[model samples]
Target chain A: MRNLLKILYTYHFLLMFIALEVISIIMLVQNNRYHSASYAVKAKAVSGSIYSTVSDFKEYLSLKEANKALAHENAILRNYLKSNYGTFDTTKISVNDSIYKQHYRFQDAKVVNNTVNKQYNYITLNKGTKHGIKPDMAVIGPQGIVGLINGVSENFSNVLPLLNVDFRVSARLKKNNYLGSVTWEGKDFEYCTLKDIPQHVQVNKGDTVITTGYTGSFPEGIMIGTVSSSKLKDGNFLSIEVKISTVFKTLSYVSVIEDLTKEEVTKLKTETEK
Target chain B: MIGEYIKIALRFFFLVVLQLLVLNNVQWSGYLNPYLYVLFILLLPFETPNWLLIILSFLLGFTIDSFSNTWGMHSAACVLTGFIRPYFLKIISPRDGYDSATRPIIRDFGLEWVIKYSLILIFIHHFALFYIEVFKFSLFFHTFLRVVLSTLFTFTLVIISHFIIYKR
Candidate 1:
């Protein structure tokens, strides 16, 4: 017993090191699972509130730029307002008013904390569960699609932005409607790679890419990026590169899109698969 | 001794806030994310207990992770650095060894020794961090570029901060 204790004492530092490393690795594995580490994310109470306060001050510094973006979005929205589409002639073929239901809602939120340089980037917003924010809601900037909500707490929410390696968006060519997935290479914030595109599709430089509603997360036609380069790789696929539209560095204001029919659609799809 | 401990504690808070608020937002070219908070771990007293060093490094990294939303990546890399630090010191120890009160700062250790020591630790830390972050050997070359560039960037910051905080 005395000799065993002596051995343990001599190697205690190494043991401690291994123990700490194991704990950290366990946390890392837990965090990589989407639902498991949701509560431990930055959107929790004290840390979330503190980051919100700090980012609030930083947000004020860019109020001018944010205001301009907001005005531009408002102008674009005004052009598509139901009122601007002109009154439909209801007298002919008395249409059922209840047949048309809104399936998407937008809520405004301020970015409280953001990081683009990390391999797994996450954005923290000033709105959360208390403000009706929820996980899986699609987040969009004024100019383009931003990210998907990962977790939400009382007053803050975390977004897995496109700059992250783990983030992927289903996108389609604006001109040809060819479907592909856009993923970051963890190298550049402004660029992401579009994969699974067949080489037969004549993809051109400067072609636009937009989100496809097939994922049910984002509305179809929301701008994603522009094809910067496309080259044939392995003779079977076109290794396409895209220049992401949203300026992530200056990103401040965003709107969380709540898909009202998501639950229904998901349920129906699962049942159909079964 | 108490005064030195208190000072380290204050520096810890300051470094965390600076990293979370200022450096986190500063991105020039996407690959140049200078992690200045690691300086806190590097600046710990020469004779700090191995257990205490590991704990302190973990706490510092965990705090940064909380703000950055990278739960365990930073802490894991930090613990690795702390675990290797004693061996690192043993390998590079001076002929007479070190004093408990002296730090690894440039002013006391001379520019050459400090640079060698800082580069070694910074390279190890950044390599561990970037590789674990990507977690894929397929992009080994890409991750290597990040490690190299970030090491240089962070090392530059470490040198500049040494001059700023410890000028005669």
Candidate 2:
């Protein structure tokens, strides 16, 4: 017992180092796998509130720009109103409207904090469970797609933005409907990469890319970015660089998309799988 | 001695605030994100207890991680740096050896010695941070570039700030 005590005393620092590193690595692995699980939510709560206060000050500085974005979005929404589009198929007897109802809902939120320089970039929003924000909801700026909500607190939420290496959005070419995955390469905030695109499809510079709606987190036709360049890689697929539309530097306002039919869809999917 | 501990404690809060509020928001680029908080770990008194050094380093990193939402990446790297710091001190010690009363600042140790000491640990800290952040060897070259670029940027900042902030 005395010899074991002597050994323990001699290597105490090494043991402490190992213990601390083990705890840190465990936290990293846990947070990375289940971003919304564990103390991440608690950490977000404390940091989120602090960032909310700081961004509140920042938000005041950009009031004019925020107003301009709101005005622009209002004009776009006004153009899509029923009055502007006219009555839909007035000649037909419309019935069973439940089958064709909208499956997505939007809640406006303010971005409290955002980081584009990190490998795993995250955005903190001022909305949370109290504001009907939840994990897996899609976030979008007025100009383009922002990210998906990763965690939520009482009054704040975190988003896994497109700038993160782990973030992958299903996107398709607007012209040919060829599907590919969009993800950040951890280099530049203004650009991301589109993978899994076959070389046979001719892709041009400035080709529009939009969400595929396969995941249902985001609806179809929402803009993601444009192809900045493309080249055939390994003689099998196209390695394409896309210029993301949302200027992350100036992003402030966003809309969180809540899928109303998510529970039903997931339930049906699980049932079919079983 | 108590007064010295109080001063170190105050410096801790000051560095944490500066790191999270100003340095973290810079977003200069992926390659140039200078991690100035590690300066706190780098400048602890030469006579600081090994256990205290490890704990303080972990706390410094944990505080920064909390603010930045990095989920313990900084803490892990900081602990590693602290663990290896004693070996670094032994290597850079003068021929006559260090005075327990004196702190390890550039003013006391001279520019050359401090430069070598800071550069080695900063490189290790950044290398571990970037590699752990990616957790993959597939992008080894890119991660290494980030490690070197960030180390250079952070080392330059540490040197400049040492002269400017600690020239007294």
Candidates' C-alpha lDDT? 0.85, 0.86
Q: Residues B1-168, candidate 1, lDDT per residue (tens digit)? A: 799889999999999989877887777776777888899889998888998999998898788776666778889899999999999998998888897767898777899999999999999999988888888898788778888998999999999999999997
Classified by CAPRI criteria, candidate 2 counts as: medium
How much does candidate 1 score in TM-score? 0.92
Chain B TM-score by candidate, in order shown: 0.96, 0.95
Which residues of candidate 2, in runs, are more than 4 Å off? A60-68, A82-89, A92-100, B164-167
The DockQ assigned to candidate 2 is 0.67
Candidate 1 chain A has its poorest 10 consecutive residues by lDDT at: A34-43
Question: For candidate 2, lDDT tens digit of each residue in B69-165?
Answer: 7877998999999999998889778998888877778778888888998999999999888898988898899879888988998999999889887
Q: What clash pairs does model 2 have?
A: none
- Name the candidate that leads on lDDT: 2
> What is the TM-score of model 1 when looking only at chain B?
0.96
Q: lDDT of candidate 2 vs native?
A: 0.86
Q: Give the TM-score of chain A in candidate 2.
A: 0.91
TM-score of each: 0.92, 0.92
